[model samples]
Each structure stands twice: as C-alpha cells, then as structure tokens.
Target: MTAVAAGTALLLTGCGLGGAPATAPVDTGGKVEGTITFQTMQLSPTFDDYLNATIDAFEAKYPGTTVKWTDIPSNAAARKVSADAIAGTLPDVMDLDTGTLAPLGRKGLTVDMATAAGDVKDSYVATAWQSFAFGGTGAAALPWYLNTPVLISNKAVLGKAGLGSSPDPTGYDELLTRSAQIAKATGVAGFQPTETGFANSLLTVGVPLVDETATKAVVNTPEAVAFVTKLAELYRSGGIPKDSVSAKERSEIETFSEGKTAYLESGGSRLKIIKENSPAVFGSVAVGKPLGDAAKRTWVVAHGLAVPTKSGNLPTAVAFAKFLTSAENQLALAKVSSVFPSTTASLNDPFFAVGDGDLTAAARRIAATGLRDGRTTVKPPAADAEYGATLWSAVQPAILGDVAPAQALGDAEAKLTKILQERQK
Candidate 1:
C-alpha cells in the first residue's frame, strides 16, 4: 500500500452505535469454554509459525476454548470487516488499523478495551494504550506492534557526496543543505523525505495540524510557510525528486531501493525488503535520527486487535485477545518479524537493547527507543480523509512551484477550517 503521511491511515477500535462504548467486562471468575474466531490483517505465511505457537499457548492455558484464526488480505480486510459488521458477523476478535477502527468505534461495534482487559493493562506503553482508547474511555484495542519512521542512508552514495555515513540533519534547513550537496555530487535525489503530504512536513517540525482545541487550522504561521517554501526550493534544486510533490510512498521506496537517493525517511521495517532485494545497497546502509525541527518527537504507527461488542463468546474472545498481546506472545512475534512490540515488558526485553553492531540492528534499536517519544503525526476528525485530501490538494500546487507557499497555505487553511467546522455539525 502507498504509505501516505504518518496519521492519515490511522484506525480506532471502538464502542457500538450510541456514542457509548460497549462493555466487554472481563468475567475473571467465570469459565471460558467456547470457540472464538480471530481475524488478522494479512499476517499469515510470514508469521505462521509464531502465530500458531501463540495460539497453541493460549489454548493450552484454557483447555476448552478454541481460537479459530483467520488471515485477511490487506486490501480486502477493511471491506470484509465492514461487510461483516453490517451482517453482524464480525469475527469474535479482529485486527484493525486506526482509520478502520475509528468509524467502527463511532458505530459502537467494538467493545471497550478498558472493560475487557484485566490487570494486564498496566503492561502496555501508556501512549499506545491511550491512542487506541480514543477519548480516554479506555482502549478498545490492544496495541500489538509499532512501525516508526527513521532516517536511513546509503553510506556509499552519501560518502561520494561528502556527507558522513550516519548523517543527522538538525532540521529542514540542514536537510536541504545536505540534500543539495548529495544531489550535486551524485546526480541523484539527495533526500527522499516522506512527502506523504503537508501533514508529514508539519508534524516532523513539531507543528500541530490544528490548535489545542482542534477547531481551526494553525499551519499558516511564518515558520510553516518557510518550511514549505524551503521544500519547494529543494525540489527545484534537485535535492528531492522532481515528482516529489505528487509522489506517493511507492515512488520514494523505489527510488531509495534502487539507490537513486542518498537519504530515505521510511519505517524501520523497510530494512527487510532492502536486505532481500538490494543486497549490495543493504551492505552500505546506515541508520540515523529522524530529521525534523524538533528534538523530542517523531512519527509512529501501529497495528492492534479489537473485539466486536456482539461476540457470542465475549469472555473467551477477550481472553484470547489479551493472550495474543501478552508480553511473551508479542516478543515471540517480534522475534520472527521486523515488528516492534508495544508492551513495556516486551520492549524491556534484553533482545531489544542488544544490537549486533550492524545497520539493521542499529535501526531497530533507534526506532524502539524513538517509539517512546513518538506519536501519530496528525489526528484528524472523523471526516479526516475528506478534509485531509482537500488540504493536500490545496498545498501541493505551492510545493510544485505552481503557487506561492503563503497563498497556498492560506487557501488550504480556509478550506480545512470550513471542513472542520462542518464536520463538527
């Protein structure tokens, strides 16, 4: 899938239709003895062994309960979930993204995680838990794993450009300077920042998309205009890809994988693909801090599991969900894939801190520590997709040199303000 900005594709696990969270109260003293179907988001084959082992462990703990696991294709998963919701046949437990889960929560189809998870709640990272909890009504899903963005460098290419192996630019200004240097020497794009849209730029610089109350657009400040304008200048100077203004993640990924760019801001998970498809490039890989205007935060995304409020085996389903996200189970999954666990216990495991002195391990360690200070770049209203699209459309022209940055941002702010106001109604 084309990775947009950090927060555009978020999902929220939620309660049923009445704006009231559905209760999935744990029956700790009761017996769990029914079959519960657990649907996953395209996690089969690659994670088959680890998942099967986790399921086996859960079943062993509760002899009479059976977990019927199902894996859905990523493209079909959301639609299938929606269809199932309409038909009242959503699996007992299912994994969802923030975007898919948010609407479901608003409809109150999913049960509240606060009532479902028992004492196991304290084990999770507070931010991860709060993110799924929406408005602090308690989480509706258990954060399973995270994918945080990191700065990756092709050392060989960067060395040719006179930049260090692990280049750490302080902000967009330094980023542009370094990128222009690389582009001048190598004749390739210098920095392939995740032009997932305007949000990506704003959030990386510690600028909130909206004001504290989220009622109006606050991105028209002088700092914002300068940032956006600089990006356009970088584009013009060949510091970024020519198509960057309209480029999606695939283009950036392709450019970086083919070593056409010196620096890439991508999720830590991309390391696996590079290792497999571009071994030569992988050998010279270097991990560095995420480039931004701020020091404390970066962009992060996660995958989590949620349960339907109408499940026939509520207790068993909730129990299994907890089991799947348990520190041990999460670690098991992390051991096999590029995923990083969300649980504090899992993160504290020695394996996470132990690096083998290689770029892959170094990147993973940087990402793991960064997740502690990370957040979704933007948290748009429920009508985020519509408004986000509008905002991006309005701003792209400026970034592409079609309009002045201040004018384009002003136009986007006006449209977004109206959109937010209308959505509140």
Candidate 2:
C-alpha cells in the first residue's frame, strides 16, 4: 500500500477545536432544522465525508434539519473563516483553532455554545471539556472531537537497541540517550522528531521560550538553553539527517516504515495511515505511552464545537454541536474516523478495550490512562502564529547542528519575543 492508497494527507491532532471558549445556554430538542455551512481542509480526508454522513443521520432523526458543508483546503480554512467573518456571511457551524477563537470571541464574532450543548457538555472528558473553556458549568460551546498525540515506535527497533518493549522513559535525558544508541548501532535515525510533532513545540520546548506562567514568551531562557543543548548534541552525534527539515506528512511516516527511524511522533490518524498505506511498516510499528516527565504537561488535543457569532442558523447549529459530541456519538465517530473520542465512556467500548495495533493501543492509552482524570494537560503552542514560525526557523539548525545551541536559541528568542509582543501592542 502507498500514501495514495491510504489516502494520506495531514492528520491534525490538537486541531485547535478546544481552546479559549465562551458559554451560552438555550433550550431546543425538538425539530431542529436549518442549513449549516461548514468548512474543512486537505488534512483529513474523512472530515467532510464523515460530517456529511453524520448530517444525514441527524436529518433522518430530526426530520427537518439540513446541513450544507463546504470543503476548503486545510491551508485555506483559516483565511476562509476570516473572509466569511468579514463578509458577514458565516457558516452556521465551522471548525477553527483555539487561538483563532480568542480573536473571534473578542470581536463578538463567536457566541457562547453552552446554549444548546447540554448533552454534549455532559458526555466529553473534563480536560477535553475544559479545552473549550465552555461557559463554566452547564454552559459550553459543544465539543466536536479530540487529538491525542503519542509516540509511535518501531518495536523491532527496540530489539536492536538491546531494550525490550519500550519502558516508561524517565526524562529527556533517557529518551535522547536511547535514540542515540539506536542510531549509532543501526545506522538509522535513532529518534525521529518530525516537524509534524509539535506536541512539544509550545509546552515542552516553549515553556522556557515564553514566560514561566505561559503568559509571556522568553524562548531564549535557560529552559530553551537546555532543550537546544540536547538537540545540538544529538544532531552532531548523527542522530538524524538534515534533509528532513522540509519533509511533509508521508515522508516522516514513510521513513519510520523503512526502518530509517526508531521512533516518530504522531496522533490517532497515524494508525489509519499505516494500516492503509504501508501495511509492512504498520505491522512493524508499535506505540508507547506519551513521552516526557512530570516536568512537562501531557500533550492533549481536543476538537470542540463553536458557533460563529455570525452564523445565521445559531439555534440549529447549537443542536448538532450537542448531538455530535454526545457520548453515543463520540463512540460512533471513533469507529468511523479511527481517532480517539473526547468522552471517557468511549474508551470502555469493546472496540477500544482490546489493543489492535500501535494506533489502537496508543489512542486507548491516552484516552484511558493518560489524561482521563484531567490531571495531565497539554496545549499546542500558538503554532500558526509567529512564535511557531520563529521556532520552525530554529528547529532545524538546533537539531542538525548547523548553528551553535546558544546562538540558535538567542536568534529564536529575539524573533519570537518580538513576534508575540507585537500582538499585545
């Protein structure tokens, strides 16, 4: 199988569905009817099709409701959402990142979703629910889906490293050392940290880049100092090649499949990609619980629902948002999309009770044990923001040893500080 056969594209974890949010309450369980326009991207092939199927099922149940969806390439969704907002012609329902929500909400372009999201609010996991920052209690913008990032490992690689199945690594120190050994012995990329793996971009590496509490960015701090130092050491040690800086989704996925890398970072949809594209690689791949230590927050990405303040079908949109994210629906979607659901009960489903593959087991690990209690939380750095671009510019050099760690960090910090502070002013 190949990427074409697997229908591979971008698999967005932390699709930014959950983030800063607002809440409102309204009552409507009867005959919900209206045409809602939605937008999706090139990232996930199933997004539009799955939504349309859901819309059909919903219309059948509700009788009079209708939904119209539009496909905007993933790269275009942001701009499309913005253009709609300006034209005063917005979809009744659409997906936007959490950061985007802050601006839209502040601009009064988004209404609180808690209004018609009662059942939805009740079903999703707490932290997942919290992502929306739904209106406190009994009030929230309905939640849509979730993205749980985990380490997808080639179990076979572990054997070569003289290690058994992956152990719970203690920290970045152990993690890097293991990868280094794997590379040196096998002549392969020991630990693969793809550009796609931004799970650590903000919270893990960015903690030092930004302020201590996360309200500010000091990316050039000692923490960044530590991060880049390890990165430079690994790069110079010949851990990974420099060509991967511009590689996209399938490249990293394919490399792991070819045994060129021992470990790679990915989310729920990765399992699907392997299953459909590279069956051989899929068989060799195994999953590990999220990597990191107590010092870092577990990376969590949830997709929630919101009403564009400009939505014409606000009431009906609220109803579907609630219905789609309900406990039953959450479970149902897991089967269709091959990703984890945002609700706790979904994990107990027999479908997830048994580990089928790296994809299945890893997603279940995150859903059942990782953040199920809401004790661990992770947020993506403002990746689509200037902070992201600054880090991107520095990641390659820092990881590949093109520049010194201190110099790379200094340049990144200066650029990022200037970038983030610009928005404040």
Best by lDDT: 1
TM-score of each: 0.84, 0.78
* Model 2 agreement with the true structure over 133-230: per-residue lDDT tens digits: 52233222455566655667777767876765658454556777887787787766666555445325435543534553223556566666676677
Whole-model Cα lDDT of every candidate shown, in order: 0.69, 0.57
lDDT of 2 at 175: 70
Models, CA RMSD each: 4.1, 6.3
Error of 2 at 301 (Å): 2.8
Give the C-alpha lDDT of model 2: 0.57
Candidate 1 residue-wise lDDT at 100: 60
